[model samples]
Every structure is written in C-alpha cells, then in structure tokens.
Target chain A: MKYFRYKEEKIFRVLMLVSTLFIVLALAIIIFSILYKGLPMLSWEMISQTPKGGFYLGKEGGILNAIIGSFYLSVCSTLLALFVSLPLALFMNIYLKRYKFVLNTVRFFLDLLWGVPSIVYGAFGFIIMIHFGLRASLLAGIITVTLFIIPIMVRAMDEVFKTVPVGLYEASLSLGSTRSETAYRVFLRQCYPGIITAVLLAFGRGIGDAASVLFTTGFTDHIPVSLMQPTATLPLAIFFQLGAPIAEVQERAYAAAAILTFFILIISILARLSSGKFQRNKINF
Target chain B: MMLQNREIRRLRDRLNVSWMIVILAIVLFLPLLLGLGLFVQSGLLLKELSIWNVLFTSQWMPMSGKFGLLSFILSSLMVTVLSLLIACPVCLLTAIHLTQYAKRYVLNIMHPVIDILAGIPSVIYGVWGILAVVPLVSKYIAPLFGVQTSGYTLLAGAIVLAIMIIPFILNILIEVFRSIPTELTEASLALGATRWQTIKFVILRKGFPGIISALGLGISRAFGETIAVLMVVGNVAKIPTGIFQPGYPLPALIANNYGEMMSIPMYQSALMFSALVLFVIVMLFNLASRIAITKFETK
Candidate 1:
C-alpha cells in the first residue's frame, strides 16, 4: 500500500508538471502565432493611414482611426475612473474605517460589478443612452467603459490603502491634521505608486474591452474629433476586419491584434514595475 | 482661539462625512442601478412573450415571433461546464505544484507566465482561437474522432475558454493553498503518509471551500465571457448535440444580433431579456463565490 501511494505521488507530480508546461506552451503559441501572421502584414502605412472605400475587400487602408480612438477612449475613461475611485478609496480607508460591515458590503458589491460581463454593461449603457436621447458616440463609450473599470480601480486602490498602518492615520490626526488633509496629503502620497499601478491596470482593461463598447461606441472610419462622434477601437477593428471574407483583410486583423497585444504587454510590464515599487514603499507597521 | 479651532475641525469632519456618504453611495449602488435598468428594459420582452415560453421553448424565430431561449441557455451551460471540466483539474494540479512541489526557480518562471496569461485580453484569445485552435481542431482533432466541422464548434469555444480561465482559477487556488497551515502537511507526513495522501486528505480538505469558490468564480467568468467565445462558437441558434456541433450561447446571441435588433419586431427587447438572464446568472455565481470565500475565511 505504501509503495502504491508513493507511485501515485510520482504520477500526480508528473501530471502537475505536464499541466504547468501546457499553460506555458499555450501562451507561447498564442504569442508566436500572432507575431508570425501579423509581422508580415504590419507596415508603417497600416499604422498611419485610414481605411479607404472597399477596405474590407482587402483594399489599401490603415487602422490609424482605431489606434487613435482606442487611445482617446482608454485615456479619457481611465482618468474619469481615477477621479471617482481615488476619492472613494480615501473615504473608505479614512472616514468609514470603523464600519467593517459597510466596507465589506461595499467590497462585495464591487466584486460583483467586477465579475459582470462587459456585454451586459453594453446593454445597460444602451438603455441609458436611449433614455437620455444620446447617440452611440465617444462620450457614450467613455461612460460605459468608466463604469466597467471603476470597480477595478477602486478595489485595487483600496487594497493598497488597507496595507497602510493604522498608527499613521492616528499620528496624523494627533498632529492636528484633518481627516481630509491626512487622507490627501499623507495617505495619497504614500500610495501613489499603487495608485499608478491601479490606473495602468484599469487602462489596460479599458483599452482591451470590446463588448462594453460594442453598441455604445458607434464605429467610424475617421478619428473622432468630438466626444459626440463615433469612434473605432482596436478590438472592434480586429473583429470587423477578421469577419471580412477577403484574406488580406483577415491579415490586417492579425496586425490589429498584434498591435493590441503589444499595447497590453507594455501596460502589463508597467503595472508590474509600479507594483514592485509600491511594495517597496508600503509601510510595514 | 481654541473655540474657533474646535469649530473649524467640526466643519471639516462634517464635510468629510458627507463626501464619504456620496462616494460610498455611488460605489455600492451603481451595479444595482445597472441591474434595475436591465430588468426594466427586459420588461418589454416579458410583456410580449410569457416568461415561461421565453425560457422553455426551443424555437427562436425573431421574424416569425417565436422568442424561446432554451437552446441558448443550454448551449451556454454546455460550453461553461465543458470548459470547467477541461480547466479545473489542470488548474488545480498546477496550483498544487506551485504551492507544494515546485522549487524557487520553477516558481520564478511560472509566476510571470501566469500573470501574463491573466493580463492577456479576451479579444486576443478570440483571434488566437480563430487562427490556431479552429484549424487544428478541424484538420486534426475532429477527423480523428470522425466529427466533421468547420472547427468553429462548442468544443472550440470550450477549449479557448478553458485556456483563458486557467490563470483565473489557478491564481485563486494558489492563494488558498498558500493560506493552509504548513503544520497540517507536516503532521500528516509524520504519520507516515505519502505526499499524495497528505495533499489529498490534509491540504485539499482544508482548502475545499476555497476550491469551490474558485470554481464558482471560474464558472461566472466562463459563462459571461463574450468576444472570445463569440469569435469561436459557430453561432447557430440551437442546442448542441455534441461538443463537435456548433451552437450559440446567450452572450453571443446578444452580441451577434444587438446591432440589427431595431429592424426586427421585439428583437431589441429579446436581446435585453438575454442580457438580463446573463446578468442574473453571473450575479448568482459571484454571490455564491463571495459567500463561500467569506465562510471559509471566517472559519
């Protein structure tokens, strides 16, 4: 029986090793396939020029409109989310510090929101837009994406703030600092690295999301100059291009995907670096 | 001067309290508001089709006024369950290895890979599925099984989703396993139990509730995943007879039809109803996970 159990342990260990290797293999395949298909099609014009007529028929064009639009949408939404999330994080860690029940309930709901599918947010956003007589414009997309990322930003920032020592708050208060003052001056300064990491995380989420903006952001070929105008995003660009019957257009989809992946990789690396810095700065008390 | 200072402090406190209330209110109530909005929007469909008929019937003809969602519901279930089946054992084993057996260098390489996996967007997975998984399955796996498909089947979606969800489940399980006391494992080992037995009877038992919650979270994620599943699933509005057959899930249904819903009568409402269904199902799973995690933590 002992020998049998030992053999079982060895077999299970091999199984675990295989599974781990499988995950790594999958990731490598995804990256390799994207680069192999995308690089040959990727060109300076593809990144600089807008699609012309019959672009979906493999006509000459670029995804510049989507590149610009994704940047605008993600940047605007990330900043908006930060404005709301920062104050909320401060409030939770400072003013409502004693109300553990309320804090947990809030965190629970935020988790639920985080878990919600982006497509449902699209539906909800569509309903709200219709009620307000709003069109599917950049503003609508920004709002929808903002709603999508607020929970993420707030939760991440909240976790960072939780790591802060209680004594620091008490010390500031004893030094005659107002709660608002201390939250803004002391806590915010201490957690800024974490806050930056959270922002990057939210930005990555915002830029990559296609479902939440599917209906809310009406697609267009031009870079949106006004918030009221429809904007194209990279994910949607990839989706539309991939759906084309033409093979060249499908290759363009690969190029678009490669661009998207590159953007996310950079953001992930930045987030990791900032988080490492955040850990170094974290108060140990 | 002292009185004036105290009054200023009082004013600041009041202002802070109000700000807290406002922020908390928005943070807590926005999701409920979104849920309520979806519910109200779906009322149009409820008015048109009896909720029972909408849920139970198999035929879904938007043009001819049939609005059944049973097939979509079933397809979603099949794909989610299949993906969970594919992912759970592998992720569980990987998590066990990470926490128990892997050396530091192995962990150093593995941790970043999992982190990178977690950060890859769903759309990239969709493109990868279309580029890689589809052809491989169609050309290789399907033929081996004598199942003919274009490769865009429920199985393809499940495979993509399983890969997508591995990091999500593994991350949670690793945390749970790490939290288990080391003494428990040592005690079992001292009793002359093999490592497998210790892991099975000691670590797994202690982490059982967390594992359940992790799976619950995985289910919620798999069920609600959109772009990747939509890209791979063949999007035929029918209950799949086999994993090799093409089928449409609810999220895919909404995504494929939402743009043209205005042209068909009651179509928009039906889409809204589908969104509501997805929302409720995901919310229930999320709540279950929260409850499970909380229960385990408190214990």
Candidate 2:
C-alpha cells in the first residue's frame, strides 16, 4: 500500500491552498471594484429622486423610487411569508408528531421547494397574475416573493423547532395546555429569536433577489402609491441602467449594485446581532 | 359544570388541530400547484407543436411561431455542467483544507467572507461579470486560446457561475468533512499512515456520498441561476460546441423574454415552457442529491 500517496497528498494540499486563494481573491476583487466604481456616483439625488426625463441618459434623476420599492417589496413579502410559514412549522413540529411518514414527506417537499429557483417562481407567479386578471404590480410581486420565501422561512424555523427538547413539549402537556397553546405560547415564546433570525434572513434573500420579481413587479419610474401599482427596484434599476449604451449610465449601475450590496450586508449583520441579543432567553439543552 | 368546562377546552384544542392541518395541506400542495401551473401555462405551446418537435428542435423564432428548445436546453446543461466542473474541485479541496488543516482563526475569518459572498445580490455578480470576468476572458484568455470572441462567451458565464456557487458548495463540503468521524482518521494515522494517506483512504471514503450530494445540489443551483448567466452568456440561441462560443440557457431564455411577450400569440407559452423545463431539471437534480444525502445519513 506504499504508493505515491505522499506526493499526491502534497499536490492536493497545494491545490486546496491555491483554489482557496483564488476564491478569496475573486470575492475581494468583486467588492473592491463595485465600491471603487460606485462611490463616485453616489449622490443625494441618486437616493432621493425618481427617474426624471432622460434619466437613463445620465440626466438629473435618482433611484429613490427603486430604494423605496425594494424596501416595500422585501418587508411586505417577509411578513406574508411569516403568516404562511409559522403555522406550517408549528404543525409539522407539534400537531403531526405521531405522523412520521407525512412529516418526512412534507419536510422533503419543503426542501425541494427551497431548491426551486426564483425564476420558476416568477414564471408561476406570472401565470397566477394572468389567471386572476392582475397586472404586474407590487401586490403581485409580494405574492410571488411570498411563495418564493415560504420554504426558506419554514425550513429555518423547522430547524429551530427541532432543537427544542421533546421534554419541553411533554412538560407543557403535563401542565394542561392544548397543542396549539403549547405551540404558540410555550414553543413560540422560546423560539422567538430563531424565528426572528429566520425572518430577517429570508428578508435579506428577498430584497436582494431580482429574478422572482423581474416580470411580476413591472418596474416603474415612481414609487408605488399602493400595492396594485408597479414600482422600481434596485436590482431591476441596475439591470436597466447597465444596459444603456452611455458610460455614465453604466457606472450608475455599479452605484446601484453598491447600494444593494450595502443593504444586504446590513441585513446579514443585523440578523446575527438580533439573534445574539435575543438568544439569552433560550433554554439550554 | 366542571366536566363541561374541560370538554370545551378539549374541543378548542381539536379545532386548533384542524386549523393546523388546513395550513399544512396548503403548504404541502404548493409544489404540486407550481408544477401544474407551469404545465397548463405551457400547454398552449405544447398543443401547437408535438412534444417531440418542440423538445428536439433548435430553431427558436418566436415571431414566426417556430419554438424549438433543444439549443436552450443543451446550453443550460452545458453551462451548469461546466460550472460544476470548475466549482466542485476548488470547493471540495478548500473545504477539506478548512476542516482538516486550517487553524481556527482562518475558519473564523473565512466564515463571514463566505456568507457575504453568498448574500451578495446576483445582479452584483452579473454586474461584476460584466465589469471583470467578461473583459478578462475576451482580452486575455480567448486570445491565448487563439479564438476571436466577445467577453460574453460560455466560458465567461461558467467562470462567473463557478464563482457564484463557491460559498454554497464549500459550506456543504465542509459539513461533509466535519461529519467524518475522528476515530477513522486517528486509527489510520496510528497505523503509521501519513496524514494525506489517511485522508485519501479514510476521510475520502467516508465522505464520498456527501461529495456526490454536494455536487448534485451545486448543479441544481447553477442550472437555474438566471441573471448572472443571462448577463454574460451572450444570449445566443445556437448550439455551442466550444467554450468560447456564446450560449443561451433555459433560465436566461425565460428571463429575457417573459416581460413583454404576453401579447404575442405563442411567445408567452414558449417562455413558460422554458421555465417548466428549468423547473423539472432542477427538481431532478435536487431529488437525486436528496436521495444521496439520505443514503449517506442512513449509513
């Protein structure tokens, strides 16, 4: 068994180091270039005004419409996802305790749903919009994004629910609580940090994602006044801006990317910070 | 009266059970509804053309009503497979290094970096692809290969896709390596085997199923990635036999065309069919990976 294993091992070791270096460098270069290119174009007007006439021609308007639209889209979608996901998570972990096969099947399907790309969700959402005679608007986008993030929120909460001690459920039952009461009162109380973290995480994903809302949202130049109105978003804003033949518009795309990246970074950090802050109440296993 | 009170409490609990079950039913049926919606939406196109004609032909002129999808399908498969080929080795090796060899501080530094990479918007990646990868491929790599090409070639798309998936695949691989029991590696080293030999025989053997699952999942992700690939892949509806050639993937096809074509007679249906194809391919890959993961876990 004494083969060229030693040389093979060294080769793999070097390969690992090199590849890791490459990936890290790639990440660094990406962020660095975006910041470099975008910081110059960052202006008060850029975040404060809607696209005026000839905006894509490097004119005098900003992307405030997209900034606000992205906020509304993600916040609204995350809330909708919570309403759908909470009950589903609670049911899987509590009401279906004795139903092992059904539980596994449901869990598997959720996992599959998590892996389903946002683009397919977009397509399906379009179908629904057409069926309901709805236009591509903030409302349609929110519904689509909700469908997109439900599995994510549910799975994250499910992981947290699984960490809960079975004894905790037994203890609550022994103390004369109903299953729903135990689920919402006892388990939910204990799992709030996990639940919050999951929501914020899903929110982060929803905000940054473009494909799910690309067709459904139908970008507009102004902030949407209502759920049914079309609105702009940073991702779509960047996409449309970058496609222009003008150099200034292309650079503005980088600025929009930087803004989107900044929001995502803040969300990730907030998610971690919020989880840490609330974790003090978690019952130790 | 006390008995009645207790009965009411029990009945309220029963109501809760039914409410939960109703939510569960909706949750469970969602995937089915998505599949059905995609089918029915695309059924209009299928009704017009034979399934064989649509799936196998490559000519895709929507203005003339010829909706052959073979080129898009092949392009999607090629880009995804190529990206996986590029990503799998780097991610697997890096994961092994992180878990098996790197110091704790290295892992700590790398964690946020990986998360940030994962969390960054796909549009940023697409923008970066346009900013960096495209130029690099066109000016340097393509010239080196003696090919005159735009930067928006299949290889450029593959490079971006590979980079985009590093965090995803690496996280899975790291978990796989960590799950390999320390006892096996220790026993191998105690038997006078080198660290590399131990990893080659003990760790690799133990983690093989996990590796397969990770790669499978990575493929699923790479295939359905739309914006970044769409930005760099040139959106050409032709069979790409070379890496430097432009290619149009399924998701890209759907994304680029879905917005305004609803007014066209068969255009919306064709785009919907492309989405359906993307969904099915992703599902198959994900199912295979899930099965692999289950097998490894059950072992």
Candidate 3:
C-alpha cells in the first residue's frame, strides 16, 4: 500500500508539471512565431526610412511615421490620465472617509469604467467627435484612449496611495506641514513607483490599442506631425494591413506587430522592475 | 498678553479649514460634470432613439430603415460563452497546480510570463489569429461540421479570444486559491483525505467565489473584444449559422460602421445605442460578480 501511494503521488506531481509546461509552451510559441516571421525584415532602412508611396519590407518604407504617431498618442493619453487620476488618488486618500456612500459609489463607477469595453469607448468617441466635427482626427483618438486609460490608472494609483503608511501623513502634519505640502512632499514621494507603474501600464494600453483608434484616428498612410491631423499607429496599421494578400504589405505588418510586441514587453518589464525597486527602497528606508 | 494671544490662535485654528474640498471637487466632480455635459449635448441625437425598436428587433441595416441588435448581441454572447468554455477549465486547473502544487521557485519563474500574456495587445492577437489559429482551424476543424472552412469564423475568433483571456482567469483563480485558509487543508489531511480529495471538497468550495469572478471577468472581456473578432469573424453582418459560420459582434458592428455613417444621425445613434447596450451588460455582469463574491465572503 505504501509503494502504491508513492507511485500515485509521483504521477500527480508529474501531471501538474506537465500542465505548467503547456502554459510555457504557449508563450514560447507566440514569441518565437512572431520573431521568426518578423525579424528578417527589421533592418535599419525599415526603422528610419520613410514609406515610399506604398508598402515595402526590407526596403525604404520604415515605420517611422507609425512609430512617431504611436509615441505622440501614447504620450498625450498617458499624461492626460496621470493628470486626472493622480488627483483622484490624492482625494481618495485625503478625504471621503466618513462619506462612505459617496465613496463607494465612486469606487463602483471607477470599477465599471475600467471594465467597460475599449470598443465601446471607441463608439462613444466617434459620436462625440463627429458631433464636434473632428471626424477621424488624432484629437478624437487621444480623447478615446484617455477614457480607457483613466480608470485603470485611478485604480492603480488609489491602491498605491492607500498602502502609503498613514503614519507618514500624520508625521508630516505634526512637523508643521500643510495638507498640500504633506500630500506632495511625503505621500507622493512614497507612491511615485506605483504612479510610474500606472503610467507605464497606460502607455502599454495606448500603443497597442486598435479598436478604440479604428474610428477615432481614421486611417492614414502618412504620419502627421500635427495632433489635429489623422495618423496611423502600429496597432491600427497592423490591423488594417495584416490581412493584405500582397506579400510585401503583409511582411511589413508582421514586422510592425513584432515592434509593437517588443514595445509592450519592455513597458511591462519596466513596470515590474520599478514596483519591485520601490518595495526594496521602502524596506531599506 | 501671552494668554490672550493663545486664545486668538485657537479661535483662528478652529475656523480655518484645509483646501481638501477644492482638490476633491477638481478630481472627482470635474469628470462627472464632463460626463453629464456630454450626455446633455448628445441628448438631441438620443431623443430620436427608441429603446424597444432599436434594441429588441433583429434587423441591423442602417442603410435601409431596419435596425436589429439581435445578431450583434448573439454573436457577442456566442464568442463569450465559447471562449470561456475553452479557457476556464484550463485556467482553473493551471491555477490549482500553481497554488496547490508548485514549488516557490517554479511559481516565481512562471508568474512573469503570465503577466506578459496580459500585457500583449488585442491587435497582435488579431494578427496572430489571422495568420496562424484561423488557418489551422479552417484546415482541420471546420470541414468536419459541413461548413465552408475559412480563416474567418466563430471558432477561430473564440480560440483566439480564449487564449487572450486565459491569463486573466488564471490570475484571478490563483488569488482565489491562495486565499483558502491553510488550516482547512491541514484538517482535511489529518482526517485521511487525499490531496486531490481535499482539493475537490475544501479548496474548490472555498475558492468558488474567486472562480466565479474569474469566469465573469473573462466572459465580459471576450464579449467586449472587437479588433480580434472583427479581424477573424469574417465580418458577415448576419447571425452565425453554426459555430463555424461568420459573425459580427455589437462592438465590431460599431467599429466597422461608426466612421462610415455621415448622412444620418440615426446611424450614429444606432452605434451609440450599441455602445450603451454593451456598457450596460458589462456593468451588470460586474455588479453581479461583485455581489456574488461579497455574499460568498460573508458565508
């Protein structure tokens, strides 16, 4: 009986091991397939050169415009979200403790906002922008992306701000600091890493978003230097052109997808590292 | 004189308040105001909207007079259900293995990859789906069902959607299993219950709420997904004939039509109507999930 039980235990462990292996295998397949199909065309000309009339991979058509537009849109949305969500975080920390009803309602709405589909936000943006006569412009896309980014940012920032030891706040006040001073000087300093994480996450969300931008940004072959003009980001480009039967266009989309994936991977890694560093920094302090 | 000065200071301190009110008003109230303002501005368009005729009817042709949300709603539900059917079991089992079985070092190495999965974009999922999963499914899976095998179908979209949501489900379930009190497991083991038996009886029961939340969020996510489904679901603006037929989800319909609608407010309003419908469904599911989880916690 003892030998049989041992065998059963070994088999169970091995089965669990195999299950874990399957997940790793899935990740490997995603990364390897993308790289295998995309890396061959990622040359210098592909990075810096301008698109010549039409799509060409391993030639003059670099994703310079798409990259620039993605950078611009991401920067705008992230900054807007940060501006809005950080203050909300600070307010949640500062007041609303006794106002449980209002506080809970706000919390619920924020959660709902976070969970609302990005595509819905796109529709909302489309209607509002069209009414304003900004049809398919970069401004519309930025606004759409902002709505999607804000809720998550607020949630992350709120969690981080709450975890900031209350003693830090009390101590600052006892040392003759004003409420604003204490918030900025002490609470902000402690929660900076979490804020950075929120920003990075929003940035990741912004760059890779396709559904929200489909109607808002419209489609343009040329990169626009101005925020008012329509522009194409990597995700939009990938979505629009990935289905192309032309081998060259499809190849360009693949390379662009790889670039987008690489960008996301870097942001996610940075978020983890910064958060980890913050924990260590706090421990040391 | 000194005593008089202290009294004055106390009175002044009692009367003066912090500017916390200003901060709260700016952060919380401003957005609410904006949302309200936008709603009011769009009220003209919404005034022409009828909840019954727009939402309940099954004909969605903005070009013609008929507008039916049935196909879009059905398609969204089909994708959500099928994707969850594929992902939930895998995720739950994976979570079980990770939380209940894996060594600490193994968990550490594996967790980041899961995070990477969550970080991957929907558009890339679309790209990958179109290139790989759709082709494989069209070739091997669809012909068995007597439907024309193409890269774009409900099955292909569901498969990609399942892959996209598995990480989310896994993340939640891991948290759920982690929260199961260790004493319950210990007590079960002391009574001669095997590990699998203990898991089946105790762990699964305790983690049921988390599991529900995981599935809820996963379904909500897959339902809301647009780009991936749009790219692969063959954009046929009709009801799917089977699991293999082409379909158009509500969000996808909104996406494919929103920019093209210029001649009519009805068209834009129809898109808004779809958005509102999607939003309400998502919000309802989220609220239900939260309430269920809370009830479970109380029990």
Candidate 1 per-residue lDDT over residues A81-181, each given as its tens digit: 98889988898898778989987888888889989999999998899888899999999999999999999899989998998888999999999888888
Measured by TM-score, the strongest candidate is 1
lDDT of 3 by residue, B1-299 (tens): 98797677555443322343454454455344434544554354457656676666687767785678888898889888988898876787788899888788988888888988887899888878877888878887876766567768888889889888888778878877887789999999999978877887899987888789768878778888888778888878777868888888888887777656656766766666677778768767877776665566556
Sort every candidate by lDDT, greatest first: 1, 2, 3
Model 3: CA > 4 A from native? A1-16, A56-60, A97-104, A278-285, B1-50, B143-148, B297-299
Of the candidates shown, which would achieve the greatest lDDT relative to the real structure?
Answer: 1
Q: In candidate 3, residue A84 scores what lDDT?
A: 73
Poorest lDDT segment (10 consecutive residues) of candidate 1 chain B: B257-266
Per-model TM-score on C-alpha atoms: 0.96, 0.96, 0.88
Candidate 1 vs candidate 2: the lDDT winner is 1
Fraction of the reference Cα-Cα interface contacts (below 8 Å) that each candidate reproduces? 0.79, 0.78, 0.53
TM-score of 1: 0.96
Candidate 1 wrong stretches, greater than 4 Å: A277-285, B1-16
Q: Would you list the rank order by DockQ, best first?
A: 1, 2, 3
Q: How well is candidate 2 docked (DockQ)?
A: 0.71
Return the lDDT, model 1, position B209. Answer: 99
What are the candidates' individual DockQ scores? 0.73, 0.71, 0.44
Residue B286 lDDT, candidate 2, scale 0-100: 96
Tens-place lDDT per residue, model 3, A235-267, is 877766676677778888888888988999899
